[model samples]
Target chain A: MDSITHAPSTEVLRAIVEAAADGVVLCDADGAVVLVNGAAREMVPGDVTSLLDRGREPGETYETTLGDRRLRVRREIFGIVHQAWYLRDVTQESARADALRAERERTQFLVEAGRRLSASLNTRRCARATAELATGLLADAAMVVLPPGGLRRTAWLRSSEAGLEEGEIPVAHADQVPGLAEALAGFPPVPSRWLDPHQAPEWLLPAGFGPVGHLLVTPLPGNGVPAGALVLARREGGAGFDDETETLVRVFAARAGAAISAAVLYQEQSATNTILAGDLRPPPLPVVDGLELAGSLRAAQQTALIGGDFYDVLPTPDGPLVTLGDVCGKGPRAAVLAGQVRHSLRALLLLERDPEQLMHLINKALLSSYTPRSHVTLVLAAIRPGDGVIDLAVAGHPAPLLLRADGVVEEVDARGTLLGAIRSGAITLRTASVDLAPGDLLLLYSDGITEAFGGPTGREMYGSVRLMTALATCAGMPATAVVERLEQLNSDWLAGGVFDDRALLAIRRSR
Target chain B: MDTAPFLIEIENPEPGTTRLTLSGDFDYTTSADLATMTPTLMSRGLSVLEVDLTGVTFIDSSGLATLIHLYDAAEEHPAEMRFVGMTPYIVHLFEVTALDQVFNLPTSAA
Candidate 1:
């Protein structure tokens, strides 16, 4: 088969080779390329002509990728004098398929990231995911900085040198990391807005972030208050983030922001709850000779802060002291003030006597630290246990009702000014001595009980008269039962709910 | 954002005296308002301040603290504050901590 014997003119042969879509190469018997068509010069790599000598079996095809193009080659014996090779480019077709695959993977990554971010309410875990997400997608390193009331200056970071680092830096260094400062200040919402790492503060250049080319700082949106920040960096000479990448990072930041804020909010609430629970837990009432005491307190509603209502009965050297009082207002602030009052009163107990005179000293002590509108109302009684003699003093407080041995209930004739109401004064707290007979009991309560209101419409106050009527029914009951009755009656008055802070302390003289 | 937790109404019922009527929840939040108002009121050369708290439903430690601090302001101005219209129970709020003697208060029938 010597086709060269009848070969057509070179011009016509060249026209046929140039018009073909596939590349055409003609080589000599020694495997040297003698002629190449226009299509062959454009589509096929120049080195493919060497395959003619390798003596590939006829009609054999080889496929490989070169640069951005995919190419296929075929060898054929032409008239036995020379071998011809054909090469075709498939770059565009393969590129379309590869792009489709990458798009699918990116979608999957976004879906999985959302799930991981919201998986747990634990703040640290969520924050860690946020840091990893940056490294997972766009940036080589990341940091998440939480606002104060949390880690303060501590931040979550991942870099090339250190796998993942939770670094605690000085707050003053925030000047170096401009984006971090802005994030902490709740300024940035757009991603990669501060991408020019070159323009970063001079101090930030050597920030151990390792030759950062670009930076993206964003705020973790606090549900109510911004919780912290997310900062990401890429190496120098790396491709700058394009619009699509910025959008992707923005979406991720939003999810992480919401998740982190939720966790931080939950942590704060849990802490507040722990403190509230501890503060509201009442201490055990102490037992004294020939005296029985019972006490209880109920908050206005669920999740209310610990209030400033308190009661205590202690056995002192002179006599047994019984005190119940309501500090002005409620909540943690009041609780702290009441705590100071209680401890100071405890210390003053041994040194001072005569309720009115003792109140004078207590007033002076309270004046030591002047807080506006601060005043204390209390019924303090020093009882000679078993002897049946009780000395009671009132400091601008509600009168204590005495359940006499008979069927009659009498109000203790007591009067006084409020504590610390005057800077310099001998307090006029009224002190009265009354002999307690067997079966006589004394009850002290915070106003939360009587002030409680309920009716069919829930607006009628229980009032002092109703409380007195309720007490008349508990005449012969034990001290514990009396306290229970007080609470039960108050609850019954409110019917479906509660009023302000309520406390009840009942002490009965043993027969 | 919301309405003030409490309201304070000021008036000059008589010469040499200033009166304030308070209503609503006067707790931690409104304490500063009262604190700021008192010093300015005292600095007006008034001899007495009369606060009517009949309408107040709640008060907190900050409220109390503000009052104690006002005592100094009153002294500096050589004026006096008389707190009135306290319910019997509210009177007890001022007594337990022995703050009753620090301010001039209404007499309890008891």
Candidate 2:
């Protein structure tokens, strides 16, 4: 080998090593200190031989720190007596790497959080999911607060040692629900300091709740105003919810807020619609000389008071005309259709006395009207006051259940083509006459009662069998009590909730 | 219960037929979205408008109403509007409401 290339002079090597920015060291095979460069001298202040022991090896690279400096150290045995070390001060690089890793983790977390938040449209489930996703990751605990009447509600959830548990947290006053008033005030991410856990509001600590040290109350603004708020609590040792983390939490809350807002609007509209749909309601139950009439109608979702289900009682020249119908859908549109059908039936009652003929006229009107055609199932009963006789006409509606004073439960055999299923002039219907004795009760209801999908198995339909069985239990009951019993049974059948509006009209004969 | 979100996809199958695909539950809140899209397609001057209900999972009174209104609009525009890719449930729904005689709907049960 050429002398200069193969083995430069010690002085030239020293000059080269000193000129390099990275720390360089040379040692003997025994790992004893032989020589050190300027950078090495600065990085390795003392005990250069011991540093050689850590660095001297062939094809080996590792990381270590020397005083305040982080170093990427590499070693190679240049010859039998010479071992060379290369040390790079990697402090800034390691910091950048750590920051990049942290950023990726945060991005991944936020994406997952956003996906989870928007996955469900159900307000309760979405609210609960918002709390779970924020807990043990974003904070120690999280709570979803529905600002009720801008004040109070019946149920709440709390994070405990056994995981998040649900219960009713009764708040006596509006101010007791911490962070609600403030959140609604538009001051979002309201950082609250809790110097003592005992001092926290009682509602915040039901029976056994958080040992929280701090809280960040963030308002979930739905359509500009705050519909609800998410309360994130950090147990002791947290430095409160910082602005950066608070921003992410607030964003999550905002997405949750939008869903809450939709539900809130739907509920509010349904309430107003119940009052507005009053025009579509059946005329007040006329005081029959020898009978009692009663009915109840409510939205299935519990969020709305009135929907597609409606009941009407009209006093005609001949007798008392009773109608209960369920339009094909719910909400304002269905309510409108229900109103139209009821009002039209009342108007048609004057022109035609036969229940079957009236149904034909109504069906024709529905098909020919410029308004969108909606399928409706109705049971029209023309009960002769003081005569104990009812003429029932069915149109794709559930059969009426009759409870006899003799304790026999029977279903009316009346059946007809569903209105709107056939052309207006082509509808086929039949009227059945039933003779009722004193203390007998007849129940007219929507399919929502018989089709309520639940039970012990949760998959079994509340078929006509169960409905008849349930009605048997209400034998000899008053008209109002009979309807209430059926409503209670329907509610009980649905373990969790209902998916259809229910309407029931009951008539009882009294001697 | 949460109402499913509505999806509206407008695809031109051929030169003159505009196919609008609807999916998710069509109820009071969401049927309006589909209704709002009909006039735009009607005014676009298509020869034949086909509503693809293959993706639609459920429809209610308002949804049917929206369809009826669309049919009415199609008639005034002189566009031959039709329905295709209907599920059996939808076919049954039309049959039950007697709307089968009014609007051209798919008959085969799916």
Candidate 3:
């Protein structure tokens, strides 16, 4: 190898510069272009000097746009009196980076959409969230048209520069917006390109919004039916909805649809339950000529507000028939059975005045019913207001406690088989009679009162002994005050813990 | 209220006799277990069915209904169903519901 070498000639240097893949420009100290490579001439097409910043320091780089292409330029000192500028086309590289950023934004938007949409079970709130989330990123303005619930009108929510607005549109108005009716009917959405933005009705957009440039309508599919539809719009000259945005709208519509439909179903079920529970609630105690009566009932399932414990006072020509019963089980199932038992007692009271005979009739009625395991524990009391005598019959229930005027609590001596429990169809009941003097009260309570699992330890039961003790304190109080005080004490014993259904009814002889 | 886990153990103390030992809460939520075990309890050659409830801590109206249902099934099978073991709490419940008269409970357990 020869060690001695000299610099290449001008022609060779020029040839090497011309062969480079990057554009090369050489400028003299006075800023006049001295040489231009073939690549540099192709990159600018015109004067390349205009693309370079004269004030830029050597070794500094900058990017600039030349027509449709992006170019990155680097300035460097080439020799004692010359500066070199290198330029490379970066259009495709920047485009790829922009695409990646947009994809990430779309993913992040969907994640936010899922979290916001799933936080509510209310229909209006969910629709509002869907519309608010779609603005800024997905469109300039967004609207959500809820599924038609009533026959005449449907609800709508809109979000735009004016903020959120809600209104109800006539059901027939759905046909005015292109593709809206089809989308609401659970049909596949038409592509945004297929829709004419000019055809959007005035009602479909917010007030003062300019001419629409792009429109997209997508159906919100539900469990088995259509939940609702989404409407997106962009102002005139704004970016049109592309294929990626359309796909994102479909995914967002799916989540919104499930949330909306679930909310709708829940509202309907709760409304129905409310009606049924209203019927099962305890009735007002009738006013007896010589007696004062008070009753209170609480359900174990607080949401349902109906449970197995129930009490009713029915009036007859002779006196009022007071009935308290607890059907087997809890919640809605038990509530239905308790209602049946109450209705049966009312019907049977018209035929038989004796408490024992009513018990027998209810037993036979329940045993022959189609529902299995329909056991009921009931107490029927027939009062003779003239003589202040109460005829009591207890069947598979806790006996009523007699509170004398002097604070002596005695359990009424009555025992019987549970109504509808035995398959033999034969029930034995030992009925008893008790006289109520003035100021004396008779208290009938469900086992929930005595069997309450609450105390200082949080696990102990509020047993009968405790109940009798509590009753002793309320001997001289009014019937209403007595029930209220007892309930308060029991609730305090629970100490925020769970409890079962409790029913209490008090009868006081006033004269 | 927290409930104890319910458990049922089946054993054959002698020929033609099936003993079911039940422990824990015997309320509405757990009564279905006994009702489902009824068909299996009434096998061929079943002369007697014995229920041991000494380990039972709680019994609700639904639990009583399940027991009554079991008794009805046993009667239909022409077999004698007896309460072999019982806590005083159960005995008191049985007496209150008048089931003590209907069911074949042990005299000593009463």
Candidate 4:
């Protein structure tokens, strides 16, 4: 007999079946377990071959219990009077389906919470909504910890499905809020999941929520800083908190903090405006050249002082240097321009001998720096001692009033367009001879004085005729008295304050 | 005219013709709010309308516009409009625009 060299086909087949990840079993006719692989043998406990003689009929379905698992046996008729059976173990697939379902449920819950948060407008309403949603959707109890004297506390607490309940939780000072303190102190947003209730610092847990079974604490970061902490607690029976809840709470808290800060700033500006309007008087002005001069000193949109209308009298070696001018507009910005003009004149006067030269320098200085919105109308005059003659220069300003000793009034006809009004334009100074004999006057006044009205008919202006007549009548009075009378006349002429602030300059040749 | 010129004079009052002279400098700031006398002056029944510029040494564009408005209104009566006491500069402004022909301009004291 040839030594039977039997190939190990059966062993190879057994190895293939045992290597399969799924449990495999082979049964014969009558639905009895005829063969079982390693996986199947290990999965089933009790007797190893007892299933082979079971009284199961051919082509019958049977439920068999093996160890802790349940198996399904199905028999089928093979060729003529032969039967085969297939067995399957379906535990892991069922577990995978359950996990997917739970994951979907958690995502839906987070989406619903986000929608509710967006519906809230103001910070207070948003906070309440956020607290309720967090507690209700996430755990047994939740609290949005606010900054309390630079700490965190459950001042407002909410329970699952219920609104705020009456209770106060001890605050966790900023130094004691566990991971939160670190976040607020300068760490980026942190999400912490605590498996053991007591693992986190005792101060971090709210007073009422004892021994957090599962706590998800996340930092509320705003404008690159941690504003506060959101604490969600889960009791033993509630769903465990996850990353989704942490992210949602974090986003809502950041937006709420920013909105609250902006509202506070708006309130402050409103209060500022009220105070500013109440105390809007003109700024104080300095006396120029023995003239009690006041122009529009109130500030406007651009500069702090109204610049156009200017008046100043500085004492020089020659005599008192008198400059009365306007930079064009009224109000504070014009006043600032007026101040600039005055400053330029002061600087130029030291170097230039002629009034025209001084004005030319001013023009050149303004041309380099003037904005399109600004222009100046100026009249510069220099008076010398022992001479009644005044070197006069005009740049688009009103003529000065020259009062003669015999009560004859002459309007200085010095003609020049306003300085800085025409670029590169020459400043003309016409030498006008006037005898400032005793009792004679030189009055330089702004337009505000002439437009004033005294009577019920406010239409008629306080014309120059009245000014000349008043000047003629008041010529004999002292210089101080003359100015007072003129101011009084101006006040009486207008119903109220000078139609505009009157900048009046009076110079009488003293005997 | 049966009644005094539709005019209310506080400083100086004339007869049938009421004159309201605006003197010194005129500009947008003062011109913004019209005085109540503007309407009252127009309401008066007078044949001669006189705005004495004699006392007015300076006038800005705003003042010139006001005078033009008054002149147009007074044109309804031929002999009613007269601008007197114009400074040389003011006259020059009116003469350049030929507005002197539209209203009676008082000659210089010369």
Worst 10 residues of 1 chain A by lDDT: A199-208
Tell me chain A's TM-score in each of the predictions. Answer: 0.61, 0.52, 0.86, 0.44
lDDT of 4 by residue, A33-125 (tens): 655666666666556454432456666776565655566665555445445454556556545776687668656755766676566444455
Give the candidate order by descending DockQ: 3, 1, 2, 4
Q: RMSD of model 4, in Å? A: 22.7
DockQ of each: 0.15, 0.14, 0.70, 0.02
Judge the docking of candidate 4 as incorrect, acceptable, medium or high: incorrect
lDDT of 4 at A301: 32
lDDT of each: 0.72, 0.73, 0.90, 0.56
Q: Cα lDDT of model 2 overall?
A: 0.73
Candidate 1 Cα lDDT to native: 0.72
Error of 1 at B87 (Å): 9.4
Regions more than 4 Å wrong, model 1: A1-242, A247-281, A300-305, A405-407, A496-498, B1-35, B43-110
lDDT of 1 by residue, A236-259 (tens): 888777776776777777788899
Error of 2 at A417 (Å): 24
Candidate 2 regions with alpha-carbon error over 4 angstroms: A1-6, A28-32, A41-58, A65-69, A148-162, A167-181, A190-215, A233-243, A263-511, B1-110
Write down the lDDT that model 4 would get: 0.56
- Give the CA lDDT, 0 to 100, for residue A106 in model 4: 59
Model 1 residue A221 lDDT?
Answer: 73
Tens-digit per-residue lDDT, B26-55, candidate 3? 987899999998988887689999999999
